[model samples]
Target: MVRMAVHQSRGRTQIKDSRRGCPRYQPHKGKSLTFGIRPEHVTEKRVHTASSQVDFSADVQVVEPMGMDTMVFFSVKGTDICARSAPQAVVGAGHRMEFTVDLHHMHLIDPEKNRVIGHRSDDKAKTSD
Candidate 1:
């Protein structure tokens, strides 16, 4: 697991399996990196009870209802983020709504290098004694 602070945000969010595959790019403590998660991963529904899942509230900026699903837009630490939700589960714009982000599906990118530095892994890490 890895903990990173979102830019302009007060606290750090924990991400699981962040450095599973990429061994060459070692992110130094306090170094800035990009956090990315698919819109589907950020949802109003809580599917997993894993430790990697985090719950937070954000003010909804816009709501686009697309028949079966809705696209919710909000801002986090000055960055605009979107969430895909069931059409019936979405609240109106300008309202505070709760969201669950599955950090296991998160991707960490090295902004300077424009490369993915870390991500979740489905397989166990191999250890050499």
Candidate 2:
């Protein structure tokens, strides 16, 4: 498992990943890699609480209400991030709201290679194939 310090608007949140032990990531361990998570994976409501789920709060910079879901815009460490949330759960811009990021769905990219190194779900799919 690897622990990453994510700098947020208010403070820093440590994200823990249980999949770091995967052999595929061993060589890249301790090297710089880009972290990514889909907007859908970052939600206002978490399906379950796991060690890989990180909770943090951010000020809403923009809110787009779609028919089925709402897209929320925020920033962390100067990087703009979007999160998909249930329309009813979305708060207006300028308001602080909490979000949970499911790291199990996160993707790690090798910066130099400019491609995805691996992710928890990807490893599972590859093994099954």
Candidate 3:
């Protein structure tokens, strides 16, 4: 897990989705939270159950081609996130690219304890009644 912090409202992002539909990042109230995202989990624009996704448009900061996929880098909430993209991703620097995060695969940690305390789950997105 990586240690990170954001403003009260920074955890959420909004995408003026070209597809008209967009994903949402459910807020975390944990005073301290750390999380890790894998490149493969970062994919081309996609939509899952509304509560299970986080979609955003990011600047294509860097693209490095690997044997089968390209390593993409961009910043979100001031943290650089890396992604494994198709080798054919011709996205170059300065262009905006949309990315999707599948909540089922994400891990969250309690920073002080340095152990994973939760996984980003769609089930948690339900507004408490």
The top-ranked prediction according to lDDT is 2
Question: What ordering of candidates by lDDT runs from best to worst?
Answer: 2, 1, 3
lDDT of 3 at 15: 28
Score residue 37 of candidate 3 by CA lDDT: 67
Q: Candidate 3 on 69-122: residue-level lDDT in tens?
A: 888888876888888777665488788888777655665566666655433343
lDDT per residue for candidate 1 within 7-74, as digits (tens), equals 32223333333323333234333567767789988999576688677788799999998888899999
Candidate 1: C-alpha RMSD after superposition = 7.0
Can you give the TM-score per candidate against the true fold? 0.70, 0.72, 0.64
How many steric overlaps does candidate 1 have? 0
| Model 3, global lDDT | 0.63
**Model 3 bad stretches (over 4 Å):** 1-29, 47-51, 118-129
Ten residues in a row with the worst lDDT in model 1?
120-129
Cα RMSDs of all predictions? 7.0, 7.0, 7.7
Report the error of model 1 at residue 18, Å: 12
